[model samples]
Every structure is written in C-alpha cells, then in structure tokens.
Target: MIFLMVELMLGVLISVAFISLLERKILSLGQSRKGPNKALFNGIGQPFSDILKLFSKEYFKFSVVSMKFYYFPPLFMIILSFLSCLIFPVVGGFLNMLDELIIYYLCLISVSSYIVIYMGWLSFSKYSLLGSYRGASMIISYEVFLFLLILLMLIYLLSKGQLFNFLTFQSVSGLVLLIYFFYLMFMGVMGLVSELNRSPIDLLEGESELVSGFNTEYLGFMFSLIFMSEYLMVIMGVLFLSGVLVWFSLLGYFVCSLIIVMVVFFRAVYPRIRYDMLMVIFWEIILPFALMFFF
Candidate 1:
C-alpha cells in the first residue's frame, strides 16, 4: 500500500510535467511560433531540460524572510496538492480507504492557495506582494461558487447513500443525476483552472501586467516548485473527475495529455479577462447556474 501511494504521487508529478510541455507546444503552434524546439532531439527533452534548470539554479535565502516562511510555503503547496490525489480512486470500483476522505480532500486542496499567499508575503517584493493580494481575493471570489459546486455534488452523492465506495459509477443515481453531475463537473473544471491560476482565468501574475506575479522575486528552484505545484493542481482537477480507480496509471496519462492540448489552445486564443470582469463572471454567471443545479 505504501509503495502504491509513492508510485501514485510520482506518476502524478511526471504526468504533470509532460502536460506542461504539451501545453507549451500546442500554445506555440496556435500563436504561429515555434514552441520549445531547441532541446535535445527536437525538444523532446525540453521538459527535462527545464527541470534540470530548476534543480541546478540558486535560491535567494536572504535574511528578509525567515526559514519557517520560506520552507513551509512551497512545502505546504505540494502537501496540499498531493493530498488531493487521495480522494481520487484511480482504479475502478476501489476505495482509497481513508475514512472522511472527501472532507480531507477538500481541506487539503484549500490549503494550496494559502501557500501562494505565504510565498508572496515573505518575498518582500512589491510584485510578489501585489500578486499575493490578487490571488487571495481571486480565490475568495471563486471559492464561493466552488463550494456550491461541491455541495451540489455532495447532494447527489448523499441521495445515493453516501457510500465509501466512490468509484462504481454503475449506480443508477449517477445516471439520474447525469445532467447535474455534468454541470457541476464543468463548473468544477473551471474552478480548478482558476484555483491553479491557469490562463484565461489567470489574473494574479498577469505576465504582461504584473511581471511573473507572485514569484518574480523567487529564483530558480523556488519558482520551479511553484510551477510544478500549479500543474499538480491541474492534474488534481482531472483526478477529481476520474470517478473510478480502474484507470489507475493509464488514465492519468491520457486525460492529462488531453487537458494539456485543451488548455494550450485556450491560452493561445483567449485574452486574459480584466480582474473585475473575472470575478463578476464567476459570481454572476457560474455561481448561480451551479446553485440552480444544487437546488
């Protein structure tokens, strides 16, 4: 069991890295520019090259930020994102066997956003501070709808006896709740993108506007961790939709690849929304629709 857990996390991490590379490539194509095609073997090794850059680079350990703040920020980010996988039964008809798993997953994923705030607050850079402020407010705005989205799912889950078995979608309830389930899932998907600060919904560190957002002051490996954690949450979103553990390792690869292309296209074509507009869109449009599904 312990071994399986480790493999699961490792697989998730690798999958996320590959997805990041895929996104870069597809977005490059859409923008009519060559993506990362310079690495070993026509950029097949670009992700690894980037990883090496992250591992080999230096981090700022100035006296401005205490060791506690610096260390816990990224650590907690990974911890939170990691725990999200636990709630996902990757295989069909199997239970992850942690009682209160649904509740635990919610708590865990919620903590990831806090870590970003910590990173910015500790960095002592204006851009970092501003990014953190935006991120905090952004999450609060979206989470209102996100929680409603989850509640709707829970309502459906409860209507079906709330069993420990989260897999087994063979239930008639899934069929009965199909419309609501799909609607909630779509909202959840959008919320997941916002939670991870993906493009189209990303406003915190708008590259053109805020200059790398929260981690502008971070060097090498620190940003690497942040970057990985972002993709980690993206994968977590896909895992949340798994609904069964049967796919196990295979499903992780397939869905992540598909999402990479989708997000890449989304980024290539869409302009980032104004911050106020982003908030209003979520609350006015997504939230009410999600609530309607619930009630």
Candidate 2:
C-alpha cells in the first residue's frame, strides 16, 4: 500500500511531465514548425532528453549574478511543490496526520512567488532586476484575490456539508457543489495563468521590454528549471483543483487541461497586453469578484 502511494505520485508526476511536452508540441504547431518528431510519439522522449541536459548543465558564475544563493530558488520550489503534493490525500483513505498537510500546502504554494522574484533579482541584469520587481508586484496583487477565492470556496463548502479533506468536498449538496465548483475552477485557472506569466497578464516579464525577463541570465539547466517549475505549478493547480470524487469536478480538469494546452499553443497568436492594463484587469475585474465572492 505504501508502495502504491509512491507509485501513484510517480504516475501523476510522469503525466504532468508529458503534459509539458504536449504543450510544446502544440506550440510548435502554432508557430508553423514541426515539433519533436525524433522521439517516440513526436518527442515523447524529449522529457528524458531534457532531464539529461539538465543534469549535464554546468552552473556558471557571473560577476553580477549571485552564485551563493542561486541554488535556493529552484531547490525550494521543487521541495515546496512535492511537499504540497504529499498532503493531497491519495486514494481517499483514513489519514494519519492531515493537519500538517494543510499547512504544507499553503506554505509551499505561497512562497512560490518568492522563487520567481529570487531568480529575477539574482540574475543581476537590468532586465532581470526590473522583472523581479514587476513579478513580485504582480504576485502580491493577485495573492489577495487568490486567498479570497479560496475562502469563498470554503464558505460554499461549509454550506453544503462537512469540511473534511479535499476529496470530501465532492460529497456536498448538488447546488452548493456546483457553486463551489465554478468558483474553484475559475480561481484555479487564474492561478495557472498567473504562474505562466503570459498575457493577458504578462506584465511580470514582458520580454519585448525586459529582454527575456527574469530568465535573461539563466542558461541551460537554470533556465529549464525555472520554466519547468512554471508549467509544473500550473499543472499542479489543475490536478489539485480536481481533488474530489464528483465526475464533473474531474471533468473540469479535462476541460482546463485542453484549454491550457490550446491557449499555450496559440499564445503568440494573441497580442501582448500593456503592463498597466494588467493592473486594471486584476484590480477592477478579478479583485472585485473575488472580494464579493468571499463576502
């Protein structure tokens, strides 16, 4: 049983990794280029190739970039993501200690923004430095909404029935569940989009302005880890957001996964938003709804 739990985690991790590759393939198709056909199933093996490259990468010490703490961002990000995953209640069984799990999830997901900021500031480039400020500001802006959204879902959950583990929320009253579902779904999508750092809200790292943004100084593996974590966080949001037994709740993930992939593919198809426009949308649109939904 313990082994099965480990296996389950590994399986989902593998699925998340594949999802990243598929996003790349779809993006390639969007850009009028054939994506990785060298690997099985048009680059199914690319993830492994990426892993190999990541291991082979040599860390460079730039005069401007801080080598001392360069390891903390990705390291903490990885630890946090995995730590959050462990508390997600696999197999829906009796729990030994669920309290720590909740705290772990919050701490892990909450500090993720710091990882982005750290990467940006540590780069020591003008672009990276500025990008760090923007990224942190954007994260701070959305975090209030994110917390309010979660609180709203909890309120609806309480109305429906007992507040147990994540999966238990699936057993709520039909009407309440539907309401909770919609609220959670939107918040999850919002979280995913924020992590992606792209337009409609790409102010964090507007590459045209920041010259590759936070990742300007990172090359090879460092760059890959930062990028990988972004996608991973999004996928994690999708998976965790679906942590329930309801068929439609799980179904929402399929829809979200499809939309996220398609959106990523057509990413360049849309024009970037102005930085200030991002602020307006977040403040006027998302925050108001978030505030009202919670209250």
Candidate 3:
C-alpha cells in the first residue's frame, strides 16, 4: 500500500507539473501571446524551475493571533487534494472503507471551502475575508448541483445495467441520453469551474477587486502551496468532471484531456462573471433545470 501510494504521489506530481505547463501553452496559443519558454528547452523545464524556486524560498506566515488557523488551511488543502485524487480509483474497490463513496469524494473535493473560508476569516485583511465569503458561497451553491448531477448520472448509468463508475461509460449510443448527458456535463463542468475558482467565476481571487483574494497576503513558499493546491484541484476536478471518461485506457485519457482543454478555453474566452449574476445563474437557472432534468 505504501509503495502504491508513493507511486501515485509521484505520478500525480508529474502530471500536475505537465498540466500546468500545457495550460500555460494553451492559454498563450488561445490569446496569441508567448507562454513559458525561458527556462530550458523552450520552457519544457519551466515546471521544474518553478518547483525549485518555490522550494528555495522561505515559508512566510501572517502574524495572526490564532496560530492554529493561520497555518492549517494550506496544509489541509494539500492533504485533501491528494486524498481526493486517491479516492478516484479506489471508489469501486473500497466500498467497505466508505459507505457512500461518491459522497466521500465530494466532501474531499468541497473541503476546500473550509480552507477558503478560513483564509478569509483568519486573515486580518478585509479583502481576504470578503473574497473567502464569495468563494465559499459560490462553491456551496454549485456543489449541490454538482452532487445532484452525479446522482443523476449514476442513475442513467445504472439503467443500462452498468456500474456507477466511468469505466462503464462507453461512447455515446442513443440521442436522448446523449443530450441529457451533455446537459449534465455542462452543469458538471460549470460546477467544476466554480469549485476550482476558475475564470469568469473566479470572484474569490478577483485581482481587480480584491488584489489576489484569499491568499493576497501569502508570499514565497507559502503562496506556492496555495497555488499548487489550486492546480491539484484542477487535476482533481478534471477527473471528476470527466467521470466515465476517466478510465485506465487511451480513450479515457483523450476524453479527460479534451475536457481539460475546454476548461482552459473558458479561461481564454470568458470574462469574469459578477458575483450576483453567478448566484442567480446557479440558484435560478442551473438548480431549477437540474431538478427538472433529474426527475
């Protein structure tokens, strides 16, 4: 088990590094700008350089009265992010370890809410607090829709006498379910973007408004942990959003990469959605339609 976990950790780290690089490249290509290309081999080694630079920096902590709250969130973010990744493959095999595996994974995914809330509240800065509140509200709202969509997906999968795993989702067969599936995927991807605090919905880290949001005060190695956590969540979100497409096969990876590209595409194309508008979209538009679709 230890060896397996070590292997998984290394694999996940490598994947995250490359995904970050690819995301930068994709964004640059999309926006018609030069991306990371300075470190080594046309910036192929940028991720490694980033890792080294972050490690070389000293960790900084805010002088919060409560030491416990100040330090725990970033560590919590890292731990839960990795756990969420591990739970993916083990979901089908470890039913005894967790009674409701999907719920368990959802908790792991959404636990970042607490971290966000804490970073906002615990920090003395009003910007962090405000950003955290917005982040928390947005995440909680969309998470409900995300959970329901997953349940709906499981039902649809089961109707075909399939297990509730992505491995069971073959290429689309029928038109009706396919349409329904895309609708659900649309909801899922939107929820994922909200969860990761990505563009158009990235109110928490609105640089123009809050000057970097929750982690505004964090610098050096401390900031890297927060940054890395977000990227890890991106990878985790891609796996969750891809769902049945996340198999141990070539097709599965292709599908996963395609979905991830769509995410980056949103970053390139869309402007940030206003906080109030985001709330209306989720509570009014997404939730109502999801309820209707599920029933």
The candidate maximizing TM-score is 3
What is the per-residue lDDT of model 2 for residues 1-295, given as tens digits with 9 covering 90 to 100? 5775677657656866787678778778778998877877667898878777877888777775557677667666765665555544554453424534444555667688777788777766889888889887787667766666556656666776666455554333223424545654555465557656755566666777988887787777766666666666665565454454323566555655655664474464667777677678778887776666554
Error of 2 at 98 (Å): 2.3
Q: Write the per-residue lDDT of candidate 1 for residues 72-161, one digit (tens) a residue.
A: 687677777776766655422134565566566666667777777878888888888899999899878887877676566556667877
TM-score of each: 0.86, 0.81, 0.88
Local accuracy of candidate 3 as per-residue lDDT tens digits, 136-250: 6777688888888767766776787865543343233122233656776767778888888888788999999999899887766667778888888888777655544455567
State each model's C-alpha RMSD to the native. Answer: 3.3, 3.6, 3.1
How high is the CA lDDT of each candidate model?
Answer: 0.70, 0.64, 0.75
Candidates arranged by lDDT, highest first: 3, 1, 2
Candidate 2 Cα misplacement greater than 4 A, ranges = 1-9, 64-66, 91-103, 170-184, 196-200, 246-256, 262-269
Winner by TM-score between candidate 3 and candidate 2: 3
- Which lDDT value does model 1 have at 259? 51
Q: Which ten residues in a row have the lowest lDDT in candidate 1?
A: 168-177
- Candidate number achieving the greatest lDDT relative to the actual structure: 3
Error of 1 at 64 (Å): 2.6
Give lDDT for model 1. 0.70
